[model samples]
Target: MIQALVIDDQEINCILVKGLLENFFPDRIRPYATSNLAEALELITTLQPELLFLDISMPEMDGFELLQHVRKQQKAEVIFVTAHDAFALDAFDHQAIGYITKPIVSEKFVRTVSRAIELIHQKTNTGLVETLKKAIITSGNNQDKRITLTSQKGLTFVDPAHILYCESSGNYTTFFLVNREQIVVSKQIGSFVSKLESHSIIRVHDRYLVNLQHVTSYIRGNGGLLVLINGKEVPVSVRRKNDLLHFFDE
Candidate 1:
């Protein structure tokens, strides 16, 4: 079963969305609706739902503000349901799993929810199993592992300690290890980043991603740059330098 929460100020919108999800997903969907952000936060802290459908415009605390709070505590995938199209880009910038515009279309809503459920399974089941397997292979012992990666070739088990950095290459991503080897993955860096974002990986540039554990120094070049433990330098766009620096400071 997939646990879900719906946060909207309007009762009708909440009921409509809940009914739609129930019709499609049946007993698999656990829907909780609330008009208050504080109550939603409380539910999140306790229930730790796998999915959250949020409305951006609200009375006291809006969806964006609620999202910030949710990201701090839980790994729930967020799907923003908003009336305005202008906030779509901003929602994605915050790493929202999906964005749905209202008045909600039944087909689109179902499709978005399905995607969210798939992502939940991928992250919790497949991703975690790979993480554990990596620990056993690397340590030659049975212990919990922290990170894992999959590619076109095969699963490349890794210790977070051995990772120097990661870089995005269009639709593909490359991971540089401390042992002077690289892991090329078919998935986009954004996908990898989403999985590892809660860990040490940080986005230094639009195309360049780095694991903070392997970041040796920050250099101010023509544009800013991140010097990794492997002695490789990755250019950071001027626009993202401040955000990177702020992330490090935290």
Candidate 2:
């Protein structure tokens, strides 16, 4: 069963959302709702829900702020709820998967939730495939030999130690190597995190993931910059600076 959460300052809004979920998706979803911001955050941590219905305007903090906190913990698909249309663009700016305005229409709500459920199913299936692939590849002592990557050309087995960094451009990720070689793959940078992160590859910014093994030096600033072995510099986000430092501290 998929876990779902609803967050709103107004008790009625929470109740209404929960009711809608119960009515439309009684068997598929295990629904929870909260009007308190503190309780909502706690629930998000504990439940690690796959879907979140969040009210954009709230007393303590808006949905966007809460969503940022959620992202740090889990990859919950968000559906922003608001009374005004102005917040719609802002919701998309935050990369919310769906947005709905009040008073909620049953048909629209069903449509949006249907899409979210489909996406969740797709991710679950993909995860299963990846798990099987990893099991087959890591069956022997050759586990650390190479990581498989798919590009426009074909599948490439790469040595993780040779990777300098990975850069993201929209949906594409370009892998840069220590030998000045580059491989472009048609997938989000986040998709490769699990596969490459074990090899000292860490995301330094939204657009850049760096291999600490190849980092020559770090230049400090607000966020900072990393000089790689191949004389290439990668900018680190301020939010991720402490993480990079802590990695070295350990």
TM-score leader: 2
Runs in model 2 deviating more than 4 A are 139-250
- Over 1-250, each residue of candidate 2 has an lDDT whose tens digit, in order, gives 7899999999999999999999999987889999999999999989999999999888799899999999999999999988978888889998888999999999999999988987787677557647756886778657546876666465666889999999999988999987787999768999988888889998999999999998989999999999987788899999999999999889
Off by over 4 Å in 1: 131-250
Error of 2 at 182 (Å): 39
For model 2, where is the 10-residue window of minimal lDDT?
148-157
Taking the tens digit of each residue's C-alpha lDDT, what string does model 1 give over 19-121?
Answer: 8888899966788877776787798998888899999999888888888888888778899998999999899998898999998888898888887876776
